[model samples]
Target: MEGRNGDAVSLLERYLKDWADESLHAKLAQVFAATNMLQDSLSHYQAALRINPQNEAATADGPKHIETTLSLF
Candidate 1:
């Protein structure tokens, strides 16, 4: 579990190298969200939006996840 978790994080970092691509960014966001890494997910979502404001999935679902995560803080 620990190794898998680390690997996931590493993959996320690698994905970020090409963060300008909305599709790739959204895919990474989904991976983070699936693993319950809400903040990381939100970050990727935001990055996606930054690259392309018209990214519907990032603009809509990103904030929803961010709000849910923030409420926990």
Candidate 2:
């Protein structure tokens, strides 16, 4: 994010307010994940998956949430 992580997240979230596209959710999840917001990231990934099970990114990343959650226990 080149030190603009907050901006990236803010812009993505703003875009999401207008667009319910799975791609947007997937991207936001990616951003959140990069920022160490695992819960938010996982939730967005799940949201993307819900909208489109075929979303490659969501399918690939969403499952990581399970692994992360398990690691916490």
lDDT of each: 0.76, 0.83
> Residue-wise lDDT of candidate 2 within 46-67, one digit each (tens)?
8998999899998884558645
- Look at candidate 2 and tell me the lDDT of residue 15: 94
User: On residues 9-39, what C-alpha lDDT tens digit does candidate 1 reach at each position?
Assistant: 6886786676558877777777777777788
The local distance difference test score of model 2 is 0.83
Candidate 2 RMSD to the real structure: 2.2
TM-score of each model, paired residue for residue: 0.68, 0.83
lDDT of 1: 0.76
Model 1 / residue 40 / CA error / Å? 0.5
Candidate 2, position 38, lDDT: 78
Against the true structure, candidate 2 reaches a TM-score of: 0.83
Q: Give the lowest summed-lDDT range of ten residues in model 1.
A: 11-20
lDDT, model 1, position 4: 74
* Best candidate, lDDT: 2
